[model samples]
Target chain A: MTHVITDACVDEKDASCMEECPVDCIYEGGSRMYIHPGECIDCGLCAEVCPNGAAVALRLLDPAAAAVHGPANDAFFTRVLPGRQAPLGSPGGASRLGPLDVDPS
Target chain B: MTTHHPAPHHPAAHHAAAHHPRAHHPAVVDAEACSAALDRGETLPWTWYADPAITALEQERIFRRSWSYVGRTDQVAQPGQFFTCEVGGVPIVVTRDRSGGLNALVNVCRHRGAQVVREDCGTRKSLQCFYHAWTYGLDGSLRGVPRGDREADFDTSQLGLRRASVDTWGPFVFVHLDPEPAPLTEMLGELPELLAAGGIDLERMRFHHRVYYTIEANWKIAVENYLECYHCPVAHPGLADVLDVSPDAYELEVRPTFATHHGVVRDIPREAGYPVQGPVVEGQYHLVWPSLKVNVNPGQPNLSFGPVHPAGPERTTGYLDYFFGDDVDEAWIKAMLAFDDQVGAEDTDLVESVQRGASSGGVERGRLLLGSEHTISAFQRFVLGRLRED
Candidate 1:
């Protein structure tokens, strides 16, 4: 199962998870940070170092909430929210597209 | 961002007018009395200690203009070694270049203001922003842009990391925000000679450890507390036991660029765990204006120096770097550090209480009792001198 960023990270976009993620899949967002689902190695390193308990394995979440976060995380990269037309992919950093200004689940 | 406007008739203003007859209300600094008090040897009005406006003024006029101490030279001794610190809220990284030259560069990335060097200390061939892959050479030249080919008009030469003036004296490293600051040697003015005269060997010292404390007091209050030993007998009994607390045993020298206190230690209690056994020794304390303190304890080859940065109007964060010679044993170093921690705890409690008193609005100002507290008065004068320059 892949890892997901929970509600605990909103407004507290602490980058410890980004630093700990071996694949560098954790991407920053407008309000909260996002972890690229396709790129995540499911190593669980992010969950261990998160001071706010924001990072969690998808299997650990309630089935209903996981269903929402799974799509929302995918949509962050795959859907153009405000300024752009296509998914962000791995444009090196989330900051390049600037903040999406959308709340992350 | 929410903006807070003070009430037209703030309670602090009313209190200042009623209780403090000498209060320079609103501005809180009476130019005439501040100047006269220097000669009279009295402390500045207490309002200076608690005013947010005054703290802002000090940030621009004092901290920015002074050569603030950043860290020890040995901290970034090797090429590519670097450490990040701040002066007046501006983040800076000090690195030793390939040619053995020390360079201080603003830590912000040109692309999105992200800090390029996140760690406190590390060795790196280049600094790269984590937000994007924009990279800079260790010498602070913008080396690479992740997608440079796509940006046809982007000029990399003009976007190199901003540099600040950096210098080193003995084991200390200092940085100045002003591009053209007076030579660090000139600013130090006889401090090196004075330390040498006091038997401090700059060559033998090596950095040991750093302890930080966040005090709920204005940065000036912490500094004033350090400038004078007047409260030693009452507040720091532990410190008084090692260093002579008597008025006659202490001598304060107020220089143009710095202030110093030389105190002869009382007889070392054989029971006291002093690593070096010797006759009575002298403790040297020096303060370079704005926010750097250097302390050399008696009976050992030890040095502690650091800066106090203002976190807010009534808050300060300070760190002290402890250094000792190669000859000192680890057990003795630990004992010395413990002793210092005990003394620091005592001072912290005292300064925090003084912050409360200054903010209470009942007390107008403090009087600097002559002879013992001249250094404190001198410090006030220096602060006023800098503030008035603008």
Candidate 2:
């Protein structure tokens, strides 16, 4: 399963996760780092490097955490977030698109 | 197991060994045509060797994506043993956990990206990064993290070291950046069998010594030099005598992932500054795709293999880890090492000169005398195709 970023990450965007991700699947939104559901290799480096433990796999999350963050994680890319006109499908690497002032509500 | 190398391909017709299309296999290589092509020279422009941008593309497309030899299996024979190396310039640490399992970790910490294992080789209970004291077990599971664990959400399991792909062929250990790369066998083709046919037993090989070489040329230039022996007569007189570097007799076999050359050793005195005649009758020089070189010299059972790594666009560096049968005499090993060194030294001079010419901007490209240098043409094509993949 893909990794889901929860509310625990709201403003605690340590961004340490961005540095360790092998596939560069984690992108920075205005408020949090979003893991691309399609691009995430389930490598778990993002979750491991997250000092706030904001990055968690969908399977490992609590039922409540998964129900909310898992869908929100997908929505962050698939349904476009604030300050964005289009969905941010897999842009390959976070470095390419850089940090965005956008995130799921 | 018997190293299953029954017959090293000493092709009576070097032409029969020509399979790659556009290769120098013209059934009957016209001597006049060969002369004309040599005059024209099918070599790439010097920029490929002198340009930093070309080197960057190679690091990304070739080295980072392909599997190359990093070390020998014996380096991690016992549990807790480990060796650190680089694959395409990325730091890697290969470890054997307490459970006897092997792991190829990123070597970079899950923390701020500092390399965790700094030593070249060692055996330890766990890895502790010097920066902030983040410790990881031999299996790559994070074990400890300084005094900062008081944070409510510091989960050690999720923060273990990142892993790459590791596999072995006989005693040769290969690593790839991809977490789970294709099986090493897929990339090895008939190499192991061919090396065996050249009279080497990886099972009997033991760690002897290693010799590192730094050359002032692109890694591709170093590799291209290895693919053919057309210059062996002029540049490597000693090697020419030892490896039957005749254009007509030198054997070249190209597989999908590797290429093999059969060098029939000339019958002569086994000088201390030269190789002895025994165990190995033919010298099998094999290259595995991107950058691995497997050399089986004629002498007591021996094998020395390693990767040609790109230090930069204008420089290449690599090491040959020598292995010989434990029963072989020490003096014989020394002589073989010396002979190999002499040839390597000569090669260093040639490649450096070639690099100078490439960087000089006086030449455009050289046409190939495909008859004797088809192997190089194939390799150059491989490099060109890879760089153009994007």
The prediction achieving the highest DockQ against the true structure is: 1
**Model 2 regions lying over 4 Å from their true place:** A1-105, B1-41, B267-275
Reference-based lDDT, residue A87, model 1? 61
TM of each candidate vs. truth = 0.72, 0.69
Model 1 per-residue lDDT tens digits across residues B149-190: 446888989888999999889888999998899999888899
Question: How high a TM-score does candidate 1 get?
Answer: 0.72
- Alpha-carbon runs more than 4 Å astray in model 1: A1-105, B1-29, B146-153, B267-276
Separately for all candidates shown, the number of backbone clashes (residues 3 or more apart, or on different chains) is: 0, 10
- Error (Å) of candidate 1 at residue B160 is 0.7
lDDT by residue for model 2 (B1-390), tens: 001111122223122112222222121123344334334556655456656666777788888889978898889989879999998889999999878998999999999999988898977656767676676778888855544433688787899899899988788888999987788889988777777777777788888877676776777778877887778788877776676677767788777887778877765542335545787887788788897888887768888787788887667778888889879988888777777767777776666667666566566556667777777767766776676666
lDDT score of model 1?
A: 0.75
DockQ of 1: 0.03
